[model samples]
Target chain A: MDSLTSPVKSAHPEGTAYGTVLDADVALRFSTLDAEYEAIRERAALLDLSGERIIEITGDAASAFAQRVLARDVEYLTAERCMTSLVLAEDGTAVDQVVVWGRETGLLLESSVGGGTRLLEHLKANADAGVEITDRTAEFALFGLEGPYAWGVVGRLIDGELAALPFESVVDTQWDGVDIVFARTGVTGEYGYKVLVPAESAEQLWTKAMEQAVPAGQEAVELAMLEVRQPVMRHEAGEGVDVLEMGAGWLVDITKEEFIGRDAVMAAFEAAAERRTVGFSGGDTVPAAGTPVTVDGEQIGEVVHAVHSIGLGSALGLLRLPPDLAAAGLKLTVGDTEVTTLTSPYVTPKSWSTPII
Target chain B: MTLEDLRAAAALRQQTCAQIKKMIVSRLDLPIEPAWITDDQPLFGRGLELDSLDVLELYVAIEAEFGVALYDSDMSVFGSVSRLADHVNPALAPSA
Candidate 1:
């Protein structure tokens, strides 16, 4: 197969930086990160997320196959409904976080960036009696419209009632003479939607969406993710931690009979999680990743993700700390700076009365 | 139920609504004042725009604060502050 390219890559002008997503080169930014970040928070911003992978699984046993590989229950999912789940290793460590969409034909699994290959292999390894898996990443281009005005832009383009759309639901519709899939999903914690269109029509869709939205890049998306306390896959997963410790136990359905790492997860829960992922603010200096967190000069945890948030106007950091030390208002030291622990999601949406996107 | 009991229950329901509103604002770190959150305002989607994750956090907070065990399937209780008060008020009543 030929190397993949994002349909909207050519639209980004000078000063645009490129980065590898999955195996494709994608535009990281068109303008300054600050400008893009502002667009996504206050107004509408369009992002080309085509670098994320989409895989299709079909056949009689597709749902059963998915149920085994993912941590969430898949038996109840119906057409146009999406469930966010974690693909786990045998030990219950997260391999990737994926959004699985139930379609009429079968199931569509959308992987987080850099997660496609491993997730595909995991699915194939656990394939049931009669299931077929295909890589559909190259066939489709994904774009996201986020921020307070996201729905308005999508409403203007689509004929349907955007207000009726529920969160985590998908709608198959036509836009500008092209077929598209609109999923009411977002990473920014604002009103948001994800648009999936054919690679051939992606440029046209991008052009139309851009008319109403300021073009944003990955860095801005990351800022939004942090403000909302959405965990980064690479930073949240790995040694010394499990999904339950990351405060994502809600994603795991204990009622489900089985899944890839169900046993390990249950055992971890039984053992009781010793540490948890929490957010912190009010630090004069932003701490680097892996910076030690201490209480009274006693080391307790390390910073997993840190950023200077323009939205909050403070340096924010996600830390893995013991439950005793993670309470809101608890003061801890990061390097020489004293920081106060706050709950996850430093930013909250101001209003839900209006259709956000 | 007796008229006196009914009156007491109504007062408890009102108190529950006030408490729930206060807990939501403080626990979720919402910027809105607790007094400003009307009883009938929707808590999810258009009214307050709280997402599923927010629902989970709110559930944990309510359970901790009020000792009311809300099931995941009982999301209708979250339709509005008034509805949540109705669901929780009876539970708060002292056992006969």
Candidate 2:
């Protein structure tokens, strides 16, 4: 099958450039990266995230099947509610971190770009009778609205009470009279919402959302991820680190009687984690992943990911280090430049006049 | 404020700091003990060295636990445990 395309691609003008993500061609930028970053930070930015895959599981055994494959409990995810979950290997290592949306018919699983294929295979291998898995990647398109004004922009386009919607909650809402699944989620830490519309209606939804939001591309989204400390699939994927070491232990439900990788995850938890993921700043240079980190001339760890943070105005990096050397204020050398370990979230969202419920 | 009032406020601030420290250690599963986190230690750099995602998780956890709302403008409050306590104490106190 051909890789799916974003409906808004045709709308981008002459300066727009495209890139590949998860086998799909996506708009990398419409203008300068700084402008796109500002749009998401100061005002609002719309992102075409259709490159991410959506898989549907339908059957009487859908819930049970999810319970078996996912690390988190699915019982709380009633219709219109979503939860971030991990698909773990039998050894308890994370295969992917996905957002599971509860639907009345069954469940919709949204994976990071290029992540659905593996997850689909895992489900098929483990599924029992009465469960049916369908790849709906091309059938729907996802658009995200992010920034301080994201809620306001979405509120103006839709007739519902958008502000009252809690984070991670999904609702069936209308945009320009087209039915769309609106979820209070985004890669950026700002107040954001994601609109999931049928492929045919995606262009219409995007145009309407764009009226109040500027177009942002992958570069801005990635910068936002780093500033907020959100883990990307590529950065988090690897050996030697389990979910606990990745700072996502809350997603695992050890109370579950049985699930894939339960024993391994339990054992990993029992053993002390040798290395942990950390964020660092105060570096003049952005180090690439696998760059060696040294403390007092002794190798302690390596950089997993790093980027020049527009928000923090410094080079920030995600590093994996020995827990003993991971304390704040600990200085380490990355290729001759000294970087100090800092707590994550180089930036925070602006205060809201009304509390987010 | 009067001396008695000052005493009460200081005591309240200390309690709030302790509570926030406990929340951070438990929610983030930090290897260090809560008592080891000094009130003046920076919560981000040169102190706990929490990553950005950890801050996001802590934000959610704090809102759920203390009924306090943190936003981008409030980022400075995270400079230290005492600063966070100073910011969140009013939110946790009984509404006048």
Candidate 3:
């Protein structure tokens, strides 16, 4: 399993910063974090999502297999729709978060950045009769446009009418006469869209899109995602961490009677939750994962992850605390500095207020 | 603050969140259990898939249930269960 690299990496700016996230080497910053972050928060950002692998599941039993594997029910997912779901291990641990794209043939699971190898392995190990999983990464390239004004970019680059399509809407459309799969999906609580174009024309599409929007790197994208509390699976999912503890229960549809990890998830849900995840912000120094969260010098939890939040102008991160202490507006200590447990969406997304015109 | 004090404060916020989640599920006629909704999950478009109509229902339900009039508040109040909890119970919101 070689590490994945962006197909458009050659076209990135000269000073781009690249880093490894799981199995992919991604652009951490194209110019500066501030510039790219501004693009995603204020204007539109062009994202080269080549780090994510696209795996197509097709065959006689594709539907049933997808229903059994995904934490969410996709039984009725038509080719006109797409959705996000968690691929959970049998014990309720998260293998990877994926975007399930409904296609005419079957379904495509777009793995979280750098998470494709593990997700591919998991699907194959569980492969049953009537299922054929194929790695289609070499055939197509995926790119994303996201921001409060990302819809405007869609209007400029593709179709003006497609800008206002319903969220999670999917359409097999065209770009510069090149057939592509377009979807109205977003990660940062913004008006986002994705285009799946042929590998040969990906660089050309990326170049054309770069004209309408700024090329944002992984750092900016992930930061905006954090501000909205979108689960960054690579950062949040840890060993012995269940969906409940990771605060990702919403990704799993517990009512679904049967699925991998259902029993373990149900047991955790039925019994008392030992610990729950909550958001916190404080201090100038970003605390490291495993940093002690204390009250009156008594440790009660640890930092799951943290980073200097450009939006908040301070450290922003998640804390895994006792269920009783997981709520917001509490004064606690994170690695010797007092931090405030705040509500979800530490920063409000502009897309909520902005509309496609 | 002491651990006991923190626990008491967290309990207050958690109680408020539980109430909000229950209200949302009941008013929206959502099929899943109220407890299934996490405190941090988004309430619009993506996570819960609540639309503008759902928001209107929640506004009325919230006014009647929690006695908080959020008609003028921005949509961010409905960003998450915990976020709505802060508005319904301002004591849980960080002091400005």
Candidate 4:
């Protein structure tokens, strides 16, 4: 690959009306897919994910305590694979979502930002169960890798072939001889990975990945892939849905074990999910995630993910709607803008999923 | 108005010390007596383990109580109960 093949910059940038990405707090932190691509293809880009919370569970009974508390089976999780689970309130409302990783001695729970303190208190309350809970977020650095060049760069430092690594699995591997946990799961829904390394090693990993990717000519994967991965979840591959929409349903074996939210999912299952997750493509401008999904000016549900797709030259979104309103060709209003409903797997991977050559 | 006057005005918004205490306590859901929280003591730091959520709720409560929206620049007012009273004092009535 040469500089011509891998452009130095993606078409989008921040603070522009054409293609912008804002986070939950309404901060224009991420630019459009083009900006992300330029960052990936040419130089090093950094994203402040300090928003991710971490929980540490130690003590003699940590494993047993987790097996009983989480919605997923922790007993089957080995040192190599990580499991995602939800800690539910008594009413089964999702209080916090956690990614549990097993170490040789104990378990680490990477929790979401909103409920970090509450989840820590809950974990500590299982006192007699002998769980020593602590928050270690300040102690580590979280970074992500995307773009076609990501594998070549990370694989050089790490021992494993990240390309062959299955998604949603956690491997405790060494990068440049430093022990790091590279998770296959990513928010961008691309062939990417997240690495949690010691704070001291962060700069080293960042510098190394940059040196490799720029020369390889692969740019950062586009935000468009985020929408594409949603439909890929339903493609009839290994229990495909991502956790955003009831993918946890396929994770927890109701018959094999008892877990939190089992009863809630079963109860909701018989009645059908009140809302179904769907894909939408609309005007050139994309709405924020929390924007209401509506049709005929009637509010229906909320948007989860939305982004400007350079591939389709329009806005795309992963939205949730009531079963009756989720049919293809059904029109809906995303905020003040109108969007047309589309089939699942909304964008084919050929052009949208990868950089258009 | 003087800081004391604003403190008094903010206090006037509270029907009773018990009511304010209950509002704070219920949000924390901690096992503490209403009498334990005096009007002057810090509602954070060593005395109260008020986490970030509690801090947000406190902002909302202050807004609702004083009818004033807290801005990012107003963070200094949230440093302590005393500071909050000082900030609200100019617009508040006495504790009577």
Candidate 5:
């Protein structure tokens, strides 16, 4: 699979920095990380989510096949609803965290940014007799609006009523006479909305949206996602890291009778977890993955991933530690800098207090 | 800090988180086991999808179970089970 470049790449600012994440070429920064982060946190930011592949599953047995593959129960998911689910391998490791959107015909799975190819292969390998898996990436372009005041953008650019739709709600709506699939969803802990538009209209819509909201690139989006503890699979998932160790078990529904990885998941749940992922923040310098986390000169854990958190004003990342030592409020050392094991939502999201009205 | 001492400190926070999880599963009458709920998963909106009525139930349950009144606290206290533990037992809260 070739790396995906955004459909609206030409519309991006000239100085925008670009980088590769997995199988996609993404805009790392539209402006400065500081400006983009501020827009996502304080106001509204537009996102060209073309990095995420939109694959549709259709045919007579699509529902059953989706149930067999997805870690969540989506057997009765209607066209008006959407949900986030982890697509797991048979060994209980994550393939990707995807947004399962309910379409009238069948269903669409939105792969995590730069995580499409792997998810597509997994879906094909498990294809049922009557299921039809189609890659719709070239047919449509996905755009997102997020932040405390993103609702205002929805009212001016689309519909006011959509601004307050229940989270994960899906609607077939229109923009300037162009049909699109609109959803009330977001990764950053803010008011978020996404529109799936025809590829030809993507640039026009992107230009208009830029007029109302600052265009945030992948770097800033991932940072806000980290602050809220949302799983960024590329940074977090690695060899031998099971869902239990990832602490992303919430994305799976173990109660369901069957799924591709149910047996392994149950085994993981039944067996005691050796290592668990937990959030941590401290140190001016961001530590690299595999950096030893020590206490009193004794190695206890290792950093899974870390970055300079604009919200924490320090290095913010996760640590894979012994289950007993994974709880919050522990004073530990990562390299030369002392760090503290912290609770989730390392930073309080302003959207929590700011109502759509 | 020694591993033994760290274990002891972690045990305290884990116990609080466990208690809160039990209270939530019991109060919400959820279909899954209390142990199934991870310490870091969100309790409302997206993860657990608990509605406003459920929030009211949890608010009362917390006051009764932990003797902590979170009614005046921001919604972020419910960000995750570990987060709620920090609020109910301030000692477990990591300093900003």
Candidate 6:
């Protein structure tokens, strides 16, 4: 793998490849900017996202009603695929982040941490009275494989051709002869898939994905196989951010006949969006997470996540900036350290963190 | 003043059993029960997991129902149905 521009490599490459430990036996690692996995933005790569929580919404009114409540158009999604969306409270604050999938009689909703309980409660209150809501977070394990080669590699794991499957497509099929529910959706900027397998069969599915991608003309998709905690970034960046500032305003459907947070989010959108979530340069010193962002001596927002990007020379951060100052080349202060603002997603898609083989 | 006078005085400032319990069930989203709740059970104990947020919501419901503003010290006064009943009785009573 090679690149014209790449972030500085971590001193301890091996330690960098593997992230902090989740458990004694399960070590996590993240790919660096020069690794082949980063190429996912352009071509393909794989990611493992087993830690994300999944919630299920079933019964008749699940689809139409959820479509009305969520930020994306859920009615248009079919069983074979998925879409990204946010669920906001009436105040426009992000109460829970969710992904909705249409699978047969119901929809599968993968929620953020603590969101499972909230989503379940929300459905119980808002969904049709007869709708059956279940928190299946305990029943299944989830894994993600992303990148351009994501489809090609994942297809090899299942019994049939996977690339032929439509985006957001889901099928109950055998992977290495194990029953699994494979959905074509992902969080990374590339085409990806999320596989839901019984907890008992998780090991088998994971082992199979690790072994199959290379043979399928795709490399193994190591999700956080390294120590890059992206969620931590989002969380640190999330405080100053309301939906409108996160570029997730699409989640707010003001025109919906009626839904939670519709008025609040729309009101916030109209009311100058006090702050905007933007990417910032770490410059010479990386601001600690939650460090306030300032411009011209006035406080704007704060840093959510700051990591030394091996792809970019300086520190890369997800920050919330006041709407007026979130443009490219805008200067801001991260703590006592002064910094410059860059375009959204300060890092390159796909190739930003990983190398293009 | 006599004990009856004390009870009367407390009653004048307290909330009704129906209003308090209704607010609890509605805020907690628990099944409605007309049975009277004695305020002795711990709000954070076994039967409920009322966190700081739940307690705050309960306060909002209490204020709305009884039309009384609760002070910070009043937060400790609510626990079991009995304590809640004792605390709200004076507020629910008709103003002299």
Candidate 5 residue lDDT tens string, A20-108: 99999999999999999999999999999999999999999999999999999998899999999999999999999999999999999
lDDT of 6 by residue, A1-357 (tens): 111110112211244343321211112334344454444444544444433456677767777678656755577677766766667665666656677776877788886433455555666676675567776755776666666566666656664476546556788877766788877665443556777888777665666666544211112122221111123213431544566565455334444555666677656655755665555665767678778876556666788666655446677766765444443344467888767544323332342233222
In Å, residue A33's CA in model 3 sits off its true spot by 0.6
Considering chain A alone, report the TM-score of candidate 4 relative to the true chain A.
0.70
Lowest lDDT 10-residue stretch of candidate 5 chain A? A340-349
Let me know the TM-score candidate 6 reaches against the reference structure: 0.61
lDDT (10s digit) by residue, model 4, range A1-357: 011110112311225222111111111234444665454433333333334556777788888778766866688787777766666544444556677877777788875533456567666664445777777766776666654345554556564476457556778778888888877654333345677888666666656654554311111233433433322221211222223243234333344356555566556555554655556788987788679976455677877666776655688766766544543344567898877654323433321134312
**Pick by DockQ: which candidate is best?**
3
Off by over 4 Å in 1: A1-5, A21-24, A351-357, B1-96
Which residue pairs come into collision in candidate 3? Answer: none
Docking class of 5: high
Models 1 onward score TM values of: 0.79, 0.80, 0.98, 0.57, 0.99, 0.61
CA shift at A207, candidate 3, in angstroms? 0.6
Candidate 3 TM-score over all chains jointly: 0.98
Worst 10 residues of 3 chain B by lDDT: B87-96
Better of 1 and 4 by DockQ: 1
Clashes of each: 3, 13, 0, 11, 0, 54
Query: What is candidate 1's lDDT per residue for A105-128, written digit by digit as tens?
Result: 988998876667777788787788
**10 residues in a row with least lDDT, candidate 2 chain A:** A348-357
Fnat of model 6, as a fraction? 0.00
Docking class of 2: incorrect
Q: Please identify which of the two predictions, 1 or 4, would achieve the higher TM-score against the true structure.
A: 1
